[model samples]
Target: MGRELLRIEHLHKEFEGKTVLDDLSLTLREGEVAVIVGPSGCGKSTLLRCVNALEPVQGGSIFLDGEEIHADPRKLPQLRQKVGMVFQSYELFPHKSILDNITLAPRMVQKRGREDAEAEALALLERVGLADRAKDYPRQLSGGQKQRVAIVRSLIMHPALMLFDEVTAALDPEMVREVLDVLLDLAKQGRTMLIVTHEMQFARAVADRILFLDDGGIVEEGRPLDFFDHPKTERAQRFLNTFTFETVKE
Candidate 1:
């Protein structure tokens, strides 16, 4: 029930004349984990990118902490720092060691001293259970480990909000949980997150609110349990039916 940390009104985005987002609107509050779920090409990732201003929207406003991000280049870097993002590809710097990958941003962007940045990075690496692998290159770590490192990299900036763009999508079944576990831990600590994911159990378990998108518009949204189990819209019900199968076996 805190003040809204993020507010999007009448959002729209198009790519080469094809509509990707259509009058989409959403809001998020401090410490809220809002998960956006939809089939491929449904603009889930685009929505996340727009929130952080990684992509420009043709229409509407994205308000981060009551400041507009879209259409304003001056605020881009600051907005990005306030809103950290973890992509599915991990996007780690291959040439840098894990420690460098984590520390580089805080040092370069935030301009913290090298010693301070390295200390923060080491602490984050240990928090993510990757302290022992700090010296390793991206290629040396498994997919899950790399994503974990990416998470730590984002954390070093101390973002007010985190956007996860399918961080576990590239991992094998056994590897997905490790990344998810870290995300869950962050959620437990009340880190605000906006996740674009295909992981239904995760959406159900962690999201404070759920948004279901299709054909460039939000078809439905509500509390995760109601949205997943008793969707009010027929489209949402059908979408959930397809995604909610394969019960997680213990």
Candidate 2:
């Protein structure tokens, strides 16, 4: 399946006395979209954080594009560049214009020339359907637009993989779909994505496979239809049963 682009082996994490993740292991194919789902505080977010090295892993290894990023400080920048992250809150800089937000990383980290970076940045804005709003500040845009801008900002770096931590969690019901549409498009484009989300329908519609996490480890994983249609574990079944007509995207 195109050489595992990401592999986690015996991963563990602890916060104070709480065990957030325990020997969690999983692998992602180069172009697969793997969705991580579970109840709150189940270590879904912790797992994602550890992969990006945003949080340290006390044990185990995380191989991203064949390099271990678990304990090596030397590979931090390179690993981070390869793994782009989108948080629940759209963390765009308030004062920076949309264009500035998208170009900030490429210009600073990648050191692309101003004109060169801006050219790419503008195209990304267009790609996210925000080309006309390039001059607007974060505060001047709606929640959906801001999130789109945030996605474009990350895409500007041309990351090999993307980590989405409930990217639409803070948005209103109506705003959630817009962001999901963009993410779905990204999936269709064959971007390797590791997403921690509650959007069951979105998962059903776009995910190639689903990983269910509980307590601290991966409880189950399979194709969306197999995982959801007939969940093997009681934990997964109970988890799925909790959703109502509103859908859990938000």
Candidate 3:
């Protein structure tokens, strides 16, 4: 663990007056991977959106590397540069090439030179094993490939923290492993990541700590082995029982 890279305090969120998250608080260290897991509608995705400042919080604060995150239009562009997010849907532009999709933000938002941005983009693509797909369009790629590209797009920005929100949820069973493998590789490289996932086996393999959310707050948290083998809370136990837990080979 390194310095605290992300901190959420007394976080609260609501949708149409219904509370989604209530008084949720957590901190993520610079090189730690914390996996959030729970049953559906547990506010797992909402929490990630709050941390990224994509959703408005009714109360509480989120600090990224000591700077508070707000939806202030003037500051959000820069703030987002430090926090890269990958969604369940691969939000790549259908018309642009993979390299273009990856390099677009760096070129336009960060104002880097084309050569510099493309060079870095190519390097990141190679890292994700998509070097050949640089010229390919999103529509040409499989769900898994597009998702990997999405991951590469985020990585090229060199974010201090990475957020994954059910990134494999939209993929077929056969496609899920390829995307998960890329994430496992990233975890091995010591990336600070907050992941919302239902893949129990993958969560167990990659998480340094597991946060079990329920009823709009963290119900239980522990190391992977401890959380999986011996859940302290009945909520967590019931949640685990819903999944046929299996060992995921690293």
Candidate 4:
């Protein structure tokens, strides 16, 4: 029920000759956490990418904080600063030390002083329980550790909205929780986020809204309790039934 921070209106996208997003419209409010769930090739990831102008929209428009994103591609740099994304791949710089990888964007793009950026990165590292590994290179850390660092790197920028694209899909079972814990903490802090993930338990525990997409359109969307316990659409019911888990966290 917070102020609207993002609005996707009649959005459309295509790859080659295929339509990936079909006149999709959704709104995200400040301090809201929206979890996107859909079957493979459903365009969940494409929606997030287009929100930040990472992908071009073939039709319709997206507005972030009331500003039209596709209005001018020239303003993308400024528009992108308010959004941050972490992908399934760790995407950490191989040669750079962990701290350097975290600080690189702030130092180059934001033109932040190295001292200030490092200090902030260190503080964020501590928050994620990885302060001790600040100077270590990406290859030296475990998969979970690298993902945690990636989240911290994004958090350091204090983005208005965070986009996560199947971040835990590449990790082993044990490593998944470590990364999810960081995200849970962020949710508790009331950060506005739009996440595309298959982690059903996390979706139930943290999301204020759950959006179920199918065939490039939203099949259903509502509060967690409503959508999870009583999905209106058959497609959503089928999707949930396939991902059965033990004792969903309250």
Candidate 5:
């Protein structure tokens, strides 16, 4: 097997007296692209947030590259540096220019020099076809453009595992492709990613493993073709029957 890049064991999380993540366990291998799909309120986003340390888990452990994430508070910054995450909202600093937004984290947390950080950020912008917009403010960009900038902001950190939570959900239909294309290129280049998305076609096209989560834990997991076409659990089958490309896109 490929060396495990992320390991989650018996994860348990609660919110307001309700269990949100219940005894969940999963592993992500280096360079593997794993997509998570489930109905709303199934704790998909919570799982990603927990992994990113935006939320604390009540139980279980998460290890990234064999080092425990919650093991050392002093090391949290270092651990986070290796795990990049982007959410549905493009949380760019409204007052900062695109270049500044991309360079801030690297310059501060990463301790990269200003010139070095800008140089690398510029190249990443070019990769996503946003080089010319470096001086533009967040308000000046399209929804797609803003999301692209958010993505590069994460990539600039050189994260080993990238987490995406329904990134395309807020975009107009025409805009989703640009963001997905960027992710597709990243996957092709072999970045380890864990994504929570309802974009079935994108998941089917890119995911190495597709997991169906329900009631706060994984109900079924398999190859994309098998999971979508031949899901093992009734919950998964019902989920598939409930959502289709048409219903989702609308």
Candidate 6:
């Protein structure tokens, strides 16, 4: 564990008068991996969105690296650069080449020279085993490959924290492993991450801490091994029993 990188205190959120999250709080340290898991509609994705400042909370606050997010709307663009987010959808520009898609942010937002941005992008692509696909478009790559490219795109920004919102949710069963492998590699590299996932095995394998959320609040949280093998609450037990398939590779 390292210094605190993200802190959420008394967080609250709602959509159209319906509560999605209520009084939730959490802390994540540098080089730590915290995985949020629970039944669907438990506010897992919404929590990630709040941390990324994509959703405005009704109360409480989120601080990333000591800077309060949502405090200054003007600084959001700069603040967002410190947090990289990957969604269930690949969200790639269909018309752009992989290289161009990955380098666009660094070039446009960061004002890095084209050569420098492209050089780093290509290196990241190669690291993810997609260097040869740099010339290809999103439509040309498989779902797994496109997702890997999305991860590389985020990495090029040099974000201090990465948020994954059900990244494998949209992938085909067979394609899940390739994408999860990249995440496992990142975990090995000690990148700080907060993930919302239903991939139980992968969650157990990668998480430094596990948060079991239900009805918009944390029901139980602890080490992955303890949570999986010995859930404290009946809610967590029932939730774990519902997943029977071995969707994630070892």
Root-mean-square deviation per candidate: 2.6, 3.2, 3.5, 3.3, 2.7, 3.2
Question: Of the pair 1 and 3, which is ahead by lDDT?
Answer: 3
Give the better candidate number (3 or 6) by lDDT. Answer: 6
lDDT of 6 by residue, 58-170 (tens): 99999999999989999999999999999899898898999999999999999999999999998999898999999998999998899999999999999999999999999
- Candidate 3 residue 12 C-alpha distance from true site, Å: 0.8
Give a tens-digit lDDT track for model 3, residues 99-143: 999999998988999999999988888887889989889999999
> Which pairs in model 3 have colliding backbones?
none
Question: Per-residue alpha-carbon lDDT of model 1 for 123-184, expressed as tens digits?
Answer: 88888888899888999999999999999999989999999999999999999999999999
TM-score of each: 0.95, 0.96, 0.96, 0.95, 0.96, 0.97
Clashing pairs in 6: none
Winner by TM-score: 6
How well is each residue in 88-178 modelled by candidate 2, as lDDT tens digits? 9989999899898989899999999999999998887888788999888999999999999989888888999999999989999999999
Model 1 stretches astray by more than 4 angstroms: 244-250
Question: Which stretches of model 2 miss by more than 4 angstroms?
Answer: 245-250
| Residue 145 lDDT (model 2) | 94
Tens digits of per-residue lDDT for model 4, 1-250: 6899999999999999899999999999999999999998999999988987889889998898999999998888888888989989979999999999999989988999999999999999999999999889999998999999999888888899999999999999999999999999999999998988999889999899999999999989999999999999999999989988778797
Instruction: Give candidate 6's whole-model lDDT.
Output: 0.95
TM-score of 3: 0.96
> What would the TM-score be for candidate 2 when compared with the true structure?
0.96
Clashes of each: 0, 0, 0, 0, 0, 0
Candidate 5 lDDT at 26 equals 99
In order, what lDDT does every prediction score? 0.90, 0.90, 0.93, 0.92, 0.94, 0.95
Tens-digit lDDT track of model 5 for 113-190: 999999999999999999999999999999999999999999999999999999999999999999999999999999
